[model samples]
Target chain A: MAYELYYWDGIQGRGEFVRLALEEAGAEYIDVARQSGHAMGTGAMLELMKSKHEPHIPFAPPFLKDGDLIVSHVANILFYLGPKLGLAPPDEKLRYVANGLQLTITDLVAEVHDTHHPIATSLYYADQKDEAKARSAAFIKERIPKFLGYFEQVLQQNPGGPTHIVGDKLSHVDLSLFQVIEGLRYAFPKAMKTYMSNYPGLTALRDTVGKRPNIAAYLRSDRRLAFNEDGIFRHYPELDLAP
Target chain B: MAYELYYWDGIQGRGEFVRLALEEAGAEYIDVARQSGHAMGTGAMLELMKSKHEPHIPFAPPFLKDGDLIVSHVANILFYLGPKLGLAPPDEKLRYVANGLQLTITDLVAEVHDTHHPIATSLYYADQKDEAKARSAAFIKERIPKFLGYFEQVLQQNPGGPTHIVGDKLSHVDLSLFQVIEGLRYAFPKAMKTYMSNYPGLTALRDTVGKRPNIAAYLRSDRRLAFNEDGIFRHYPELDLAP
Candidate 1:
């Protein structure tokens, strides 16, 4: 059976990370919540979540259903799918390293989300614009350098090669990194334009991943959602700082 | 070889989650940063982090070193250690479920940290007091209930029983959940006083875990650090709403 991906429709959000990997491997999967029909769509996704009988209930969306098993969390989903999709290193040890790297990306993504919703996720962005400005300023100045610098260092120091994040091949970490770079560029075009030159390895990897035959095709397809304010990586001009 | 755990000294932050598991299993390990030797201590931890030759550089503290392998991130470390320490499910399928639950706890822990430092980790609590207040209000009202409710439901619905989180036995996720409840009570005593009644399974699990011989001994020993302002859970009266 094809995998069922349950995430909120319209916005890419965290689901984009999973979608990127599936797209890269050309895996057979259904974007369940995106389907417009009875017994499908966002309502179906919520029904699974709110179901009392469901044993392994996910705390939130972006969960993947494979047969009777349900995997939640982007990194967890990627870890489970990586080996099956042939998007992970052959070495078992290196797979853990890939997972650790993906978890770091997860941390960075959470920080990025907080840049706009500094005060409260329940509150509108306008309600906490002042806090968002303060958070975004610090995020641009300190966090971006710290996180992106760490990734750059990892890429530069990888034994396999600078082209890949883990072993000497394309893995899910690279795809997620590619998506992160794309999101950051979209959200902070001004800042990234100045900062992109600092991380040459990351920049080259992002470019290489973008040019991949499947990824290139996916980018042109309607399945790849555009970055918007509703997504995790939102381009609020006021939050974008020139580094 | 004894496992080497590196985390910043002085408080029970993320490291506490790791510590709880080790303590429960009676695993022999060294708290690297807390040691006061010439070649050890926080300086040594920094040296390892700054070492360009180290292939698997951890992004932050709370990383575990065993032999030549290094595991980072609370959830990742627990996932790796769970099987070794016999703190995970015996069945392979249930292990994935255990990991998913642990990841959800990880998300909740990050949110709890942000209740005090909503703006930026670089900024002191005093600097972000106003934003923290706003964030904590929403956290107490919506997030706490949501996260705690999910866990409570999981425990209540567990096929094994309400005592354990994953299978029929104690797991790292249960230990982590115990620590979370303890931290929340310390950080928001007033709010938790009113909200504790809502999560019966969690509350009972916390009590059960605390009563365990090893955990009881660890709590009484100097190894378990007290919760304070320096830790993720801080008791700021202003931020603790009467929920």
Candidate 2:
């Protein structure tokens, strides 16, 4: 049976990470909430999160249901899929490295989310705009450099050139890095442009991952959702850094 | 060779999650930064983090260096250890469930951290105390119930009595829950006292895990570091809710 992915129907949030990997691998999976006429949408997703029978319910959306297994958390889902989809290194050491990189991406994603909602997730963006502004400034100035620099260092140390984040192979981490770069470019265009030139290896890696036939095709396909204000990576002009 | 756990030496912080699992399994590992006269103290740990490596390094601490594999992220490290140390369920589905639960714990931990550091991770608690007071109140009222209720529901659904979070065996998730309970009690004694009685299953699970010989021994040993202000869960009277 095809794997079933359960997440909010609209907006490419954390679920997109899983969707990208599945699309790249040409894995058979159904986007359950997106299916027409299905009761499964954001509501069903939330209900499952509060399910009394599932001892391992997720705290939020972007959960995957593969037969009997229900998995959540972007990195955790990727950890399982990395091996299953051949998107991970075959060696245990390399796999761990890939996972480590993915977790860092998770941190970057959290930072991105914090940019808009610094005070609380439940509070409105308007309620915390000032706090968000301050946090976003620090993120753009400090966090973006620190994170991108770490990725650049990783690429330089690869011994395999500036193509892959791990070794010579294209792993899940490469795809994630591509997504992060794309999201940052969309979300904080000015800030990313200011820092992009400093990280040539990361730029090359992102460009290479984008050019992959499967990824390239997926990007052009109708299945790929557009980024919007509702998504984690939002592009508000007021939040952008000064050029 | 033994595993080398690299994290801040002083507080339990995120590293304790990894430490508890290692100790429970009786795995040979060194708390690298905690060892005296060993160059791998906080300074060395900072240097390693700032190192320009090929595989992107971890953004923060609680990373493990196992031979050539440098694994970071508390949940990610446990994901690796669960299977390797025989603490995870043997079945693939069950393994996914355990991981899902661990990720849920991660969300809870993030909430607990936000109670004190609502503004930004880089900012001091004093700088954000006003916002933290409001944020912590919401967390004590909303997040605590939501997370505890979910965990209690998990235990009630476990099919395997109130003893474990997964199946009949003691998984890494159970250990994490034990830590969560301990941290919550430390951070919000009055608030927890008011609501914890509602989560009997979770309370029982915590009690049972606490009674485990290995965990009990580890808690008494110097190996279990004390919780403090520098850690994720801190007890500030101003942030606490009155019973």
Candidate 3:
């Protein structure tokens, strides 16, 4: 049966991480909320989240339904889907390592979101622009490098080589890392200019993931959502910085 | 062999989540960095984090070494340690549900840290006081209530009754929730003034976990680190709210 993926309709946000993996594996799935004339539309997605009737409760969207099983959280969802979709190594040790890497990516994603919504998620960007400016400055100068640098080191030390994040083949983490690079680049082009030069290993992985046939096809399709101000990786000129 | 946990020596921080589960289960383990006159001192902790030679790479501390296996990330570490520690259910569905709840707690812990370091982790709280004030206000008024309310709902909906988060047994999630309550209480006593009365199920669960024979002993022992401003949950009186 095709997996049912429930997430917000408009922007990629956290759901994109799950989508990237599903697409890369050529897994049959439906983006429930984004679909039309279906029982699992945007309203249905919110209902599943808020309803206490579910066998499993989801605090938010971007949950997956595989047969009778349900899973949530980007890392948790990927953890479940990684092996099933053949995106993770079979060895237990390497599999957990891939999970750790995905969790780290989750951390980076949260940091990226904070750059724009420093004060409060409920508040508009205009209401918290000053705070965001300061936050974004620190993020662009310190955090981006810290996170990207750490990923570079992880790539450099990869036993399989500096290509995939874990082992020799493509893993969910590689796909997620590619998304991180894409989101970061779109949001902070000026800051990422130096990062591209400083972390050739990460860039190479990103380029490789981008060139994957399935991912390449997905990126070229209209199904791939654009990074926008409403989403996690917003491209405000003030948030971007140059070396 | 006993597990070797490497984290900061002084603060409970994220490591405490792993510590709580181990403590509650009466497991044999060493809080490596916290001990003295050993190979696994604070110095060794830093060395392992910086070293690229280990089988697994940890971007930060709060990593665990079990035999040759190394794991990082609080939720990821807990996922690996849960079943082994007898802190998770045997049933696969409930186990993953517990994991989802733990990952949600991870999200809450990150938010708690952001209250102090909203602008940047590198910047001191004093430097970001204004931003923190705004962030904490939003947190207390909105995020705290939303998260706590969700947990309350989770408890109320439990088929086994509101005694535990996942199944009828005491999982790592309940312990983590107890810690979250403790951390929030310590950091935002004034803000959590109504939390005791409002979230009766949550508060009740916290009381039960606190009274667990092993947990009660651990809390009284020197092994249990005190909640301090140095950690994720910080008590800046200015950040606390009345309602």
* Candidate 1 chain B, poorest ten consecutive residues by summed lDDT: B49-58
Residue range B119-217, candidate 3, lDDT tens digits: 988888899898898889899999998999999998988876789988888899999999999999999998788766889999999999999999999
**Residue pair clashes in candidate 1:** none
Candidate 3 backbone collisions, by pair: none
Q: Of models 2 and 3, which has the larger DockQ?
A: 3
Q: Please list, in the order the candidates appear, how each scores on TM-score for chain B only.
A: 0.98, 0.96, 0.97
Per-residue CA lDDT of model 3 for A1-243, tens digit only, reads 999999988899999999999999898999999987757799988887777876567888778988767788999998888889999888888888898989989999999998889989998999998888888888888888888988999899887888888988999999999999999999999888877899999999989999999999999999998888888999999878774
Runs with alpha carbons beyond 4 Å of true place in candidate 3: none
Query: Interface RMSD of candidate 2?
Result: 2.3
TM-score-best of 1 and 2: 1
Question: Under CAPRI classification, how is model 3 graded?
Answer: medium
Q: Candidate 2 — which residues are off by over 4 angstroms?
A: A38-40, B52-56
lDDT of candidate 1 over A1-243, digit per residue (tens): 899999999898999999999999999999999998886899999999888888888999889999989899999999999999999999987888898999999999999999999878888999999999999999999999899999999898898989998899999999999999999999988889989899999999999999999999999999998999999999999999997
Candidate rank order under TM-score: 1, 3, 2
**Predictions' DockQ, in order:** 0.82, 0.61, 0.74
Angstrom error of the Cα, residue A2, model 3: value is 1.3
